[model samples]
Target: PGPFAVNTATFVGYNLGGFLGAAMATLGVVLPSFLIILIIARFVYNFLEYRTIRAGFEGVKAVVVGLIFAVVLNLLEKNIFGGTLAFKNADFVALGIMLFVLVLKLVFKKKLSAIAIIVISGILGLIFYGMFPL
Candidate 1:
């Protein structure tokens, strides 16, 4: 989506020169990648049959999961723990909301929709933070 949208916009911007210019701009951006993929697509498929290549891909997947978990921890630290892991600095209201949602998810299974969770969170946010300002 990102490449398609940007490439299309670039083509349109070529109209700053003319329609031909736009067409050239779009093709210039898209052609190289299309050609490269076309050339390498078969080799890539064959390479995937190798054990070492498959293991490398699995390692990449693990790294991606680790990176995602690190991001979640950083956000949790900054938002709920005030950028540090001190127990006293933790926002209990945010923690309570997180726990409540976790419970709902575990206990209810597929009973709750995303909208319902969001609405419940907002109401809880208002009730906890609105009524009692910390």
Candidate 2:
């Protein structure tokens, strides 16, 4: 075959081996995660309802958040803002873009889907990069 084509919208139009290849890959990747999630769910039911476990989880969540915040702050301070804004322009421009997004999210105050954001960002990146090659 010069070109392999399959109707993705129709389930019955595809081959079994191709379908099983997808299913096998999915099973290989997800089985361990599914088992882990099942175990975590069981643990949540058993432990999370209690005061001690609840507090411990809350503290753990806080620590994780703090770690992420610190990483973000470090990135912004070092990479985005840089040492001297008067000398550098690209870092300042990136920092401005980050601030713009943060302001947009804050002003909108609506739950935005990560998928939609990612898709839009990727499309915008492609358009900008294609239109202005520098």
Best by lDDT: 1
RMSD of model 1, in Å? Answer: 8.3
Question: Which run of 10 residues does model 2 get worst, by summed lDDT?
Answer: 1-10
Give TM-scores for every candidate, taking all chains together and pairing residue i with residue i. Answer: 0.47, 0.49
Clashes of each: 0, 0
Candidate 1 regions exceeding 4 Å error are 1-12, 83-134
Which ranges of candidate 2 are over 4 A from the true structure? 1-19, 81-134
Mark the 10 consecutive residues where model 1 has the least summed lDDT: 84-93
Residue-wise C-alpha lDDT for candidate 2, range 47-91, written one tens digit per residue: 867999899988997998699679968877886577754325565
**What C-alpha lDDT, on a 0 to 100 scale, does residue 17 get in candidate 2?**
49
Error of 2 at 72 (Å): 1.1
